[model samples]
Target: MALAKLGEGANTGCMTQTDDSLRDHFLVASPYLEDAGFHGAVVYLCEHSAEGAMGIVVNQPLEITVGEVLDQLDIRRERPDQPVYAGGPVQTERGFVLHRTGGDWHGTIPVSDRISLTVSRDVLEAIGRGDGPRQYLMALGYSGWGEGQLEEELASNSWLVTPADDDLLFRTPDESRYAGVLRAMGIDLNQLTNTVGHA
Candidate 1:
């Protein structure tokens, strides 16, 4: 698959939430984050509100394949080689599919006009039958934050927020999404330092 390069946009330095909703945004883990699971992760925020936040880490491809997952469920696999991702730290046994909007699946949440997140088995059934969305990533688990948790992290510079792009979410290779999002936001990954600026 050709990795589409994202177009450059304003270099808005590290962003902290104001009043805008972060749903459908990209949560790029700061380089200094000490958590091993999230290092270099690019999370696609599916739900973000005053109560809490939920997202799936899109760039951490596990050694497993979608076929492997379906096989465990006794579902037939037509696309066996597609890589699966380690979505986050919660519910590792559960599966989540981040795909382009086109199917009528149960438990589907529209993340954006073009993207949706599905947790129901029917989506997987359709995929096993070779009738799923053309662009999709199957992941196990998802990142989550409690009320005011994400905002605290944002205030502490633990993450950088940017508008999520479909190509970056669906077209870019899993290994390249972190840098891809940084590039799109006019950020040079090498130039990012761990030092937090204080006013």
Candidate 2:
């Protein structure tokens, strides 16, 4: 669903819906999103269907350190070294928790149930206590797809889609997610053209 919004460029316009009809796909950036907020973004397809897809830009790390945000909330990182991600352009001041599930810590968005998104403040407090999920990434915003938006993008190849892995979501280094997702598709970053437009 994240790639469905590829209407912003050319590669998306040339794609056909049949190109990808599977579940839990990843959106691989084309190496040209120069915007500091989205440069080399990697998104996770949470939902993809005829209605359209919705995703979260998981790998775009923001200059805002987790420790800094903690200060904003009057809390401090249990581990000062934790990284903070851009999430997306929405709710830059809000927080979203992308974390491992099936643990004793309940109450989440139940993205896949196995993988959940928590927008609650409690997650933050839990993190401060060092009693949160096994692994997690904190993001400032999120990405969304409207009905029919993703389908059109798939036809244009704006987003190179591939399977999603929980390990990758929780463990992949933020700096490498964009290219890393492409690697999952066995693609070379140099092979993608920066030319974006509707074919």
Best by lDDT: 1
User: What are the per-residue Cα lDDT tens digits for candidate 1 across 11-74?
Assistant: 2122233367798899998865667778888999987777778889999899999887788878
CA displacement after TM-score superposition, residue 135 of candidate 2 (Å): 0.9
Whole-model lDDT, model 2 = 0.62
TM-score of each: 0.86, 0.75
For residues 3-96, could you state the per-residue lDDT of candidate 2 as single tens digits? Answer: 2111111111211233444445677655434345445778876555565555678886777776676677787567755778776775465566
Error of 2 at 92 (Å): 2.3
TM-score of decoy 1? 0.86
| Alpha-carbon local distance difference test for all models | 0.79, 0.62
Q: Candidate 2: where are CA atoms >4 Å away?
A: 1-23, 31-39, 103-107, 193-199
Candidate with top TM-score is 1
lDDT score at residue 97, model 1, on the 0-100 scale: 84
